[model samples]
Target: MFFFFRKMNAVYLAAITAAFFMVACQTNPNAKKLDTGTEGTIHISVDETYQPLIDSEIKVFESLYPKAHIIPTYKPEVECFKDLLNDSARLIIVTRDFNQQERDYFKQIKITPNSLLLAWDALALVVNKANPDSALNMNQVRGIMDGTNKDRKWQLVFDNANSSTVRYIMDSINKGKPLPTNTMAAKTNPEVVDYVSKNKDAIGVIGVSWISDPNDSLSIAFTEKVSVVRLRADNGSDFVKPYQAYIGIGSYPLKRGFYFCLKEPYRGLGSGFATFLGSYEGQLIIKQFRLFPARLNVVFREANLK
Candidate 1:
């Protein structure tokens, strides 16, 4: 009887040991979560145009959630999406949604992003500070881009190849029209500004957020070097500069929404950040960017109403 009891006790101890090992493996640090578990570092990638807004937002979020750290990578708008698709990033802050082709590409990879339109922005055209022109009508702008009308010629400049301004000009102005081979491309917006400032015929097209708010030191510096261009309809009669008031009132024709692309709904820190952006504080930041906030609020700007 003692021998039999000894053998049985040994078997019981072995079973407990196996169970403990299983539990330990299940909680292994490198183990994949059963449900895409949380508590990992939040990797965010954003387009250069939204660098100011998103960088500031991430700082605020970190203050709110100390344990959550956001590693933000900045790239051109097109490259930002590429990073998300390639799994280098889990979140994307951009100005537009993925079209059908992009959606299909993600589907091929079995990764679907949740696109959240966080705020609205408008593309602004800028010229040298010494240039007297303050505005260009949509038609004139298109004419210059399409290379159809030579009289409206200006040395059009663009940001990096993957920038949102390049995309916008392609979509809104070119519209499949063959562009002139003479247009120049700058490596960066600052380069474009420098080129425009030095040349009388140069016009720099950039994301409005770059200079939308004049309060920032960088923005003020840019304004001192280059003048923001406005758009008018038809024959340059109703010239309108890109502004929060103009975009809010639908007077700005180039307004578009910025989005937060996520892989999941409200399951992770991405959702929390999105929620905070939709809140009052986020709207305030949007207002500060000189773009229309998601929620309606009265913003004051000096303009001639006549």
Candidate 2:
């Protein structure tokens, strides 16, 4: 009888232990239930430089589906990447694609992030309407960027210290050289336009969308305040602004590709939004903004008058 009781007690304890672990395994304390992506909410990070265009896209996306909720956070390019890598954000929109090292790191973690080319974005240089010089070549821009130019009267202003515009100048144009000492950093793109508008000598580097679409009120206001600089080609033959034709034809020297990187493993909200962004409607929105759509064909119409 004593042996029988002892064996029964052991069996009871084992059953209890198994049940505890089973419950714990089913409900992991740290595991969050990711959204199904169709009806639930999700957060997306976008580069601050592309706010005007991305904001318009989101407004249309949410209006089509009443059940879905999307919260967009706009920050500097580097911080946007940080939010994505830390899992705070499942999607990120910015310039450029992932490098080999980034791909390898994602592979190690068993996550192959998918990306889409959304549009061709260009950095536009704006100056006060009062400024006499409205055209600049790569050399003049480079000189202003690095503070070695003969024209000390021109002051360079950027969106912010961490903006992709500054990164592009430093990494691509200046070959990783330091920025000029006379540079100013504004809190946002609108501020850049405002500063340039008020200061005759201030030359602001900004994303073209800030002043591209005439339909947008902000863009109209921006155009009223500043003059978009016509950039001279390296060969010195033609001068063009960040107009759609120039960006599409690859003549705009300060242009970059806007892309979205999504890391959702399942067909969640991320997958749905990514599909939408590359779809016809999304591309249309991009076209309306006057940027070059990456996934769609853009037709320019001209009437010949004899």
lDDT for each candidate structure: 0.74, 0.84
Per-candidate Cα RMSD to the true structure, in Å, reads 4.5, 5.3
Instruction: Please provide, for model 2 over 63-83, each residue's C-alpha lDDT reduced to its tens digit, 9 standing for 90 to 100.
Output: 987778888999998888788
- Count of backbone collisions in candidate 2: 2
lDDT of 1 by residue, 114-200 (tens): 776767788878887777767667777788887776775677788787788888778877896765677787977668778888988
Alpha-carbon lDDT of model 2: 0.84
Q: 200 in model 1: Cα distance from truth in Å? A: 2.2
Query: Model 2 off-target regions past 4 Å?
Result: 1-34, 214-222, 300-306
- Which pairs of residues collide in model 2? 37-268, 37-269
Quick one: RMSD of model 1?
Answer: 4.5
